[model samples]
Target chain A: MFAHPFLQNAFLAGTFVALAAGLVGWFLVLRAQVFTADVLSHVAFTGALAALAAGLDARIGLFAVTLLVALAMGALGRRARPGDVVIGGVFAWVLGLGVFFLTLYTTVRSGTGNGSAGVTVLFGSIFGLTASRAVGTAVVALVICALLLLLARPLLFASLDENVAAARGVPVRLLGFAFLLLVGGTAAESTQVVGALLILGLLAAPAGAAHRLTTRPLRGLALSAGIAVASVWIGLTASFLVPVLPPSFAILAVASLTYLGAAVGTRLRGTRPTVVER
Target chain B: MTGTFSWNLLADLREMWSLPFMLNAFRAGTIVAVPAALVGWFMVLRRQSFAGHTLAMVGFPGAAAAVWLGIGATVGYLAFGVLAALLFALLPAGRGGGDESSAVGTVQALALASGMLFVALYKGFLNGTSALLFGSFLGITSRQVVLLGVVAAVALTVLALVGRPLLFASVDGDVARAHGVPVRSLGGVFLVLLGVTAAEVGQITGALLVFALLVLPPATVQVLTTRPARGLAASVLLAVVTVWVALFAAYYSPYPLGFWLTTIAFGGFVLAYAGRAVVDRIGRLAVAP
Candidate 1:
């Protein structure tokens, strides 16, 4: 699995992205923001295309746009009623922009006589990423993981207990905004590896499966990242053998199956019923 | 600049309607908007927006499988959507709300991934995945238009019969259950209705933009009104007006119909929110310092 150059890049890229996604996903789940995490994936779709429409690197728009939108969602969600309503509003808002950007990218490409080589906004083009780009992606993912570790203590405090953490002078709102930005970053990176639409599976599944097994924050976090990285390894290996279907979908499948397996396993034990996080 | 501001709106409208496809597009849009808005209103009211969204996501796989199987894409959409809906309904009932969403989220994520897999497996897929995002709305033929009419008629009529009980159940499931409304069964029925509506709207707006059509208008309307009947009517009205205006704009402009529809719908929501905030401020001022 590691001998081929393209395969190496795929493995490395998937590893880094999954690690970051898993770490942030634990917080996303604990915070009851899986929908928000999903929303950021959609935003990343527009961000990448919006970049190409302006003749810039797709990665630049991918990160910049998602980070900004994440901040905006965090701020707006605080003021909006019925949290689901806010999420729905954001979904519509981002999708409209994605449609606009998609049209713009297609039209601009056709007009400029450029080959249709831009980012594939529908599912992503992870299989086509060059080795150098994959390395850069891994480096960014590492930086994101490091940043997450720095904030892990307070972030968990806030995620587990917002009002109590706020009363403890934890700057809960700031942490929320900051956490969303991290989610946005993870989303942008994950989009490159599995496309935007599938990022939700990568981010949510591993953490969910880990949560199913254990409730302790650190153990669950480690287990989540482990599951995520393992999913990538197995998915990449499976795609290598097949080489037909894209690896992103395979990665998502592995992650989802892990969660399902864990869900079933936990149910069988009858010790831990799935707790609804409020 | 091709579609610069025109003073003679009527002339532009006349020119647009001259084309048969444009007429078909508008006709289809008109049909799909009603039930979408009606169900959308209840979706938001019941706080099932997440489930609604998950259903929309499932439509992608539904449509993709339809194309892969050489059956019509419409069949795939309805089949996959309804299948997913049944699956969601079957998730262990009444586990804490949190567990249900997680399960729903897991199903949604898996469905989306499976959609990609199905598209990839089709080997002949050059554009099927993208179609799942934007849909092929501009090329509506007369047959599809007629199909749209049948679907819209059935969805609206069913909604009419179930609308009252559905709303009561949505507002207070426990109370409705006490009143012999079969709340659990009604929940299943509503999810199925939502599935059909998603498949219907997926034809107009594509799976990606389905959330816009199904979630935005009703959410915006709810932000403005609390009265049940009035709110329902307003949501449907908003859906109709936005679709009509968006159809007109898309025909004259160089954009896909779904884009114009989403933007116009979002614009309505934002404007309503601002109006509500302003009115609330005035009411507060009148009541106190």
Candidate 2:
């Protein structure tokens, strides 16, 4: 599994994504904007199509649009903000754009008889990874990791107690926008290996499972990164064994199972009831 | 092309009473919206909106895979959604007091990654790609209608029957658990209902926008009302109205139903919020008298 170029590239990509996702996702989970991040993935999709339509690189388009969208979202809500409403607005508009772009792309192409190029972009072609693609993913992941490390404490403070963090002099708005951009960049990089639709799993699942298994934040983050890497490796290798299975599904399956295992473990532990009350 | 919008939507509206396909779209939209409103109420109340979105995203890859393999996408989608939901239900709720959002967010990511991988394998399915994005309310067959009907009925019935206890648990989980309401069990049950809601809505709204109906209405209702029954009523009304209006708009305006419905729903929310703000301001001025 490790010997194959595709698997090796996937491993490297997955590891990088795991680290970034582990850190960013830890904060995302804390902020309760998980759906907001997922919406950005759809936004990324529309951006990809727009870029392709303009004859630009899809990845660059995806990152750029997602970054802009994230900034717009962050700018909407201020201290004691109604962030969810803004997120909700962005979510609907972005999805509407995705559908609209697809329709436009298809209708125009059909008139010219160029044979559906847009459809291929949606499903994504992860097996087409080159050394450069792998290297690009690594660079993005490293930058994200470094930024996350610098901002981790302030971010944790903002996430856990926004009012207090702000009163304590954290630039909460800038940090929030920066974190959103980080999530966007990670999502884009992960999209290359896992595709846009499923990158959320790489972003969210390992951290979630780790959250369940531990209470300490740093320990949880470490566990999340480890779990994310393992799930990706397992998924990439297993998909190869099945021949017809897509690598994204393999990543999802393994991650979901890992989550399942952690969940069951927590349930059986019966230490504390497994339901939160608001 | 007609630049002016007319009663053209009425043609689709009237045909809905006569044509099986049109009727199916209406029926599908209505049935799905009921459970969507109900389960969505809890989703909003508990801040579990991300879980619902994640369940829907989980279904995307399965739907894509089903299309690639020439199978029913709904079945594949349902399987993935249920799995994701159960995993969610099994996590320790107060492990770090941050378990809910963090856990759900992570799983949402995992589900999405899996979906992308599966979608990639089927390199040649036109319907699969379109179906995953825009959806085809007009394209649903009688078989899908029946399937959706059964699932929707089960989901709505469960939601209705469990309404009181679920509310009890949602409003104050610790109190409900102390009173022997089986709070944990209800949480699990709610997630399953959310899973079903995602599957049904996935047919009409596509997997991505499923959260629009499942989360938005109830959440908006939450902003306006404090009473549970009022909130439920408001959510249902908001959802049904948004769906039909969007359905009509899509039928006549030459735009996809998902886009139009989302637009209408979002517009309605803004208008409602604005109306409340204006009314409150006027009431304050009047009180000065």
Candidate 3:
């Protein structure tokens, strides 16, 4: 299945991104910060577009923009009851800027004026992966995964019960900002391989699906990571057969299947009826 | 810079009335905003704002994929929208406080990325996908208007029939369930209805502004009233009015309907809040309570 050099790089890149997404996503699901993740991912788009407009590497630009945006969201979410409004406003503005920047870039294409810039910015072709870009994406993903592992316990403590964690002097607000940064980095890394808009699915679905199978936090994290890795493996293999199929679809189709399987397994495992009171 | 009142603006508005398609577009926008505003009120009350956004985003890929396949955009939009709703319904209930948001977010990401990929697969697809994003009310055809009309009618009818029970469920799930309201079933049924509403509105206002319609009315009412029924009634009325104002403005202005609707909805919310603050201060001073 992995005969081509492109396929080899795609598989490696996919694994790193999926693993980081799975880890951070586990906490994201636990904390109910899916909206934050969505906003951060969109921020990455604006950053990438800005990079493209400036004739720079889109990945670095995406990571920088996303980190700053995520930190700002963390600050806002800590202070306000309607923090979501802030996130929503930022999301809209970033999207508007992305569209505007993308339009400007396309209109002023460097005589490759043949429309290649628009394609790269919009769809992000994984099949045409150069070795260097793939390696860079993989390394970034690995770094994100490492950061997630190191902060796993503190992040989980705060996510599960912020009040209790704060009582215990766990630095909950700081941890929240840190977690948001991790989410941003993971989102940026995953976007390189799976594309930006779909990183939320890759991050949240496996973890969300795992949450369905069990309420135990540690077990949930493990299962989330396992499910994510398995999905990357399956998606890589599936994309081989249908070369026309995009990597994002392969990841989605596989992750969705895993979600269904976990749901069914959980239902079947608890068939014993609870005593009902009239 | 084209000044806000530059001759181009005048020319744009004058030429807008000259075209039959522009008239149809205006009619289409009016028809859409009614149901969209009404349904959007319930959407916010039910705390499905983020879910509604996600559903719209997922519709992106469906539309994009359809564009790639040389098919009608509406078919793709509705198809993906319904599929997303079903996915949400089938997931375990009460899994998280943001069950709808989580499911919708996951699906939105997948839909958006996949749409991009499909558009990328074929060359020369940038222009086609642009319409799905920014949208064009000026060049809308008669067929699209009919389709939008049908979608709006079906969504509104379903919403009306289930509105009471859904409202009950939204206000107090436990009490409703205790009274044999089948809260879960109601959620599933309403999600399907919302799926259709979202698809139609998503086409008109883009995914983002749909939230404006959903969130603004309820939020505005909350600033003024504490009674549930009164709040709901006021919310629906406010939504309808905002839609009316936004539609006419979009018709008169050169910008897209979605942009105008968002700005108008936000403005309406601000106005309502400002009025409430003024009234509260005046009443406090007079009554000395």
Q: What's model 2's lDDT at A277?
A: 24
Best by DockQ: 1
Question: For each predicted model, how many residue pairs clash, with residues at least 3 apart or on different chains?
Answer: 0, 9, 0
Estimate the Cα RMSD of every predicted model relative to the unseen true structure.
2.3, 4.3, 4.7
Model 2: residue B190 alpha-carbon error in angstroms: 2.6
lDDT of each: 0.81, 0.73, 0.71
lDDT of 3 by residue, B104-145 (tens): 666776677677777768657766666676555656788899
Candidate numbers sorted by DockQ from highest down: 1, 2, 3
Residue B83, candidate 1: C-alpha displacement in angstroms: 0.7
Per-prediction DockQ scores?
Answer: 0.55, 0.42, 0.30
Tens-place lDDT per residue, model 2, B140-168, is 78788788889988888888888899999
- Of the candidates numbered 1 and 3, which has the greater lDDT value? 1
Two-way DockQ contest, 2 vs 3, winner? 2
Off by over 4 Å in 1: A79-82, A111-119, A274-277, B1-11, B95-98
lDDT of 1: 0.81
Predicted chain B of candidate 1, TM-score versus the true chain B: 0.94
lDDT of each residue in B49-130, candidate 1, tens digit only: 8889889889888888888788888888888888988988887776534346656777887888788788788976755566
